[model samples]
Every structure is written in structure tokens, then in C-alpha cells.
Target: MRTDIELDESLMREAMTLTGLKTATAVVEAALRALVEQSQRHRALDKLAGIGWQGDLGVLRDPRSSDPE
Candidate 1:
């Protein structure tokens, strides 16, 4: 968790300014969290994209349908 790596100072400053993060550590942590969340969202969307829907919309929208489940 304490690995040190070189990063662009200007980019770091920009990230700090944009995110209102005071330190490099905060910026890095926030960036990592955003990356993880974005990856999870993309994976969820991919899974949803693979699913197929062939049901009638009118039946779902109707209030008189007997079988709601």
C-alpha cells in the first residue's frame, strides 16, 4: 500500500485542483476508487447488454393483467 511511483506533477496538481484534494495521497486514492467504480459499472452494463427482452410492453403496462409475476 506504500508503493512509490513517478507521476506528472502538473497532472497531479490538476487532479488536486479538480477534485479539491489537498494531498497526492488523497488524489491517488480518489482516482483509484473512481477507476474501480467505473470498471464495475462497465461490467454491469456489459452483462445487461447480453440479456435479451422479448416481452410485450403493453401487457406490462396494463393494470388488468392477472399474472403480475
Candidate 2:
């Protein structure tokens, strides 16, 4: 896919340097991927937030400390 758009030169250069990407397209794609992944992670966290957890979290951290019944 090809599209024409204007991007901030300073921001683009910074992204390129940080990501070590040689082209504007690569940098843009990488940024898009990161944004999409972050959004997905946020969505998953939000869904999990609505659930009611009843178990003791401490047991998971140290199973040996918990008595086996």
C-alpha cells in the first residue's frame, strides 16, 4: 500500500535513529505496529479488569509457603 502524507521531520528522524531503520516507510511501519500492539494489550488489560478474582495472589508467588489441603 502507498499513500502520500506529511510527517514531522524531527520526530521521524528521532524514530529512525532509535529504531535503526534506514527508511521512512520502515520507521512508519514499526511505529504503527507498536501502536497497534499497545492498543491490543490495553484492550486485554481492560477486559481482565472487569473480572472478579477470588483466589489469594500470595499463594501464586510462593506455593511452598501455602499449606496443601
Candidate 3:
């Protein structure tokens, strides 16, 4: 898809410099990918935040130890 859109020159220049990306397309694609991945990670964290663990969490401290039955 080809589209023409106006972008902030200063921000673009800074991104190009910091990323060392030679082309606008590459820089934009990398930025978009990072944005999506970050959003996904945050969503996963939010879901995990609602979960509550029950029982002996101390088992996690020493997996080698066994409980007698």
C-alpha cells in the first residue's frame, strides 16, 4: 500500500538518527512493530494481574524438595 502522509520532520530525523535506519519505510515499520508488540505485552500483563494463586507457593522456592504423603 502506498500512501502519502505528513510527518513531523524533527521527530522523524531524531528517530532516523537514533535507530540508524536508512529509509523512512524501514523506520516506520520498525516503530509500528515495536508499538504493536509493546501493546500486546501490556495486555498480557493486565490479564495476568487479575489471576490469584492459591496453595503452597513455597514449593516454587525449592523444586527438589518432595512432600511426604
TM-score top scorer: 2
For model 1 the TM-score comes to 0.74
Better of 2 and 3 by TM-score: 2
- Which segments of candidate 3 are over 4 A away from where they belong? 54-69
Candidate 3, overall lDDT?
0.89
Which segments of model 1 are wrong by more than 4 Å? Answer: 55-69
Candidate 3 local lDDT, 1-69, one digit each (tens): 788978998999999999999988888999999999999999999989969878777776776767756
Measured over all alpha carbons after superposition, the RMSD of each candidate to the real structure, in angstroms, is 3.9, 3.0, 3.6
Candidate 1, residue 20: Cα displacement in angstroms equals 0.5
Model 2 lDDT, full chain set: 0.93
Candidate 2, backbone clash total: 0
What TM-score would every model get versus the actual structure?
A: 0.74, 0.76, 0.72
Q: Give per-residue CA lDDT, model 2, range 1-69, as digits (tens).
A: 999999999999998999999999999899899999999999999989968978878877996976889
Ranking by TM-score: 2, 1, 3
CA lDDT of each prediction against the hidden true structure: 0.93, 0.93, 0.89
Better of 1 and 3 by TM-score: 1
| Candidate 3 lowest-lDDT run of ten | 60-69
Clashes of each: 0, 0, 0
